[model samples]
Target: MKINFDKYHGCGNDFIIINNLSNTFPKDSENQIKKICNRRFGIGADGLILINYNDKFPFEMIYYNSDGKISTMCGNGGRCVMHYCYSNDIIDNKSEFLACDGIHHGIINDDYVKVSMSDVNGYEKYNDYLFLNTGSPHLVKFVDDVSSLDLINISRNIQKSNRFDNGVNVNLVSRKNDNLYEIRTYERGVEDETLSCGTGAVASALALNILSLINSKTVNLDTKGGLLTVDFNKSNSKYTDIHLSGKVKKVFTGILEL
Candidate 1:
């Protein structure tokens, strides 16, 4: 079989997107999906996304980790999907789409895409880390230098801990200033350090705010890939109107044979 796909990346988190409007893509072909996302053997990407036709929304986003597992909400992937829709003339500048978490609203301006994120109710504060769910579970730790730490070993230890049931994404954040922070993240599903993680960035910003480390509603996050902006409103203990914005680009398009 020959599969046509478009590649896009938000920051450095790339995805292989397929227009599955005909519902012909094999949803259960985990091995094939994994092979397609393999860096050495296939069209490499951090994840795969399928833009399927939806009855209630403009489209439905079906996301899969590079490991071929249907994973939780991916912030950067969501932005890329929206941009893909806009670039393909599937929708106008604004769109509402269905994701794993729920309905998400997105807007595209030039090469930048902004998408509304899910609200966070509260967080669990630990001695050195804060645990929260921003569409996906995350453990945020404030560090002195993001680049100096051993991320692989640290994330491995955390994932093995009993604190989380399934496993959690780890974010090592170093505050550059009150509103700017540099972050390194180990994503759970990807099971490695990604260049940029949207949900991880959101979790870090909100966690810092909860600890009074940051004083602004809008925060800038510096990732290994690039810069991302997160804006939110805090009402009591609930965080709402969250938005994640960053630049996304189309890398290339090709057909893969299986």
Candidate 2:
């Protein structure tokens, strides 16, 4: 079988996106999905996304990590999906779409795509780190310099520890200024560090604010891939109207045979 797919990346977090409105792709084909995401042998990507039909919304986003397992909400992937929908004429400048987490609103402005993220009720403050769920669970730790740390070793140790039952994405953050910060993330599903992570960015920003490390509600994150902006409104202990914005690019389109 030959399957057509389009590739897009939001700040270097790339995905293989397929228009599955016809329900042609099997959601349970784990092995095939894994092969397709293989870097050396297949079309390399951090994950795969399917834009499927929806009853009440413009579309539904189904995501899978490179490991071929269904995963939680991915912020960068969500932004890429929104851009794909808009570029394909499936949605206009603004629309709502459903994902693994819940429904989210998206908007397109010039070259950037802004999406509304789920509200965070609160976070857990640990001795050295902060834990929160910004669509996905993440553990954020402040560091002196994000570039000097051994990310894989540190993140692997945390993953193997008893701290989290399922596992958690680990984020190493360094504050550059009140509004600017640098982040490096080890994603749970990906099981490694990618160029960027949207949900991880959100989690880190919220964590920083909770600790009073930053002075503004709007924060800029410098990921390995690119820069992303997170804006939110805090009322008491809850964060609402959270938005993640960044540039998304269509890399290519191709057909793969299986």
Encode model 1's per-residue lDDT on 2-55: one tens digit a residue: 778899999999999998888878757888988989999988999999999999
lDDT of 2 at 238: 99
Model 2 RMSD in angstroms: 1.1
Clashes of 1: 0
Number of the top lDDT candidate: 1
Error of 1 at 227 (Å): 0.4
Poorest stretch of ten by lDDT in candidate 1: 158-167
**Per-model TM against the reference:** 0.97, 0.97
Local distance difference test, per candidate?
A: 0.92, 0.91
The pairs that clash in candidate 1 are none
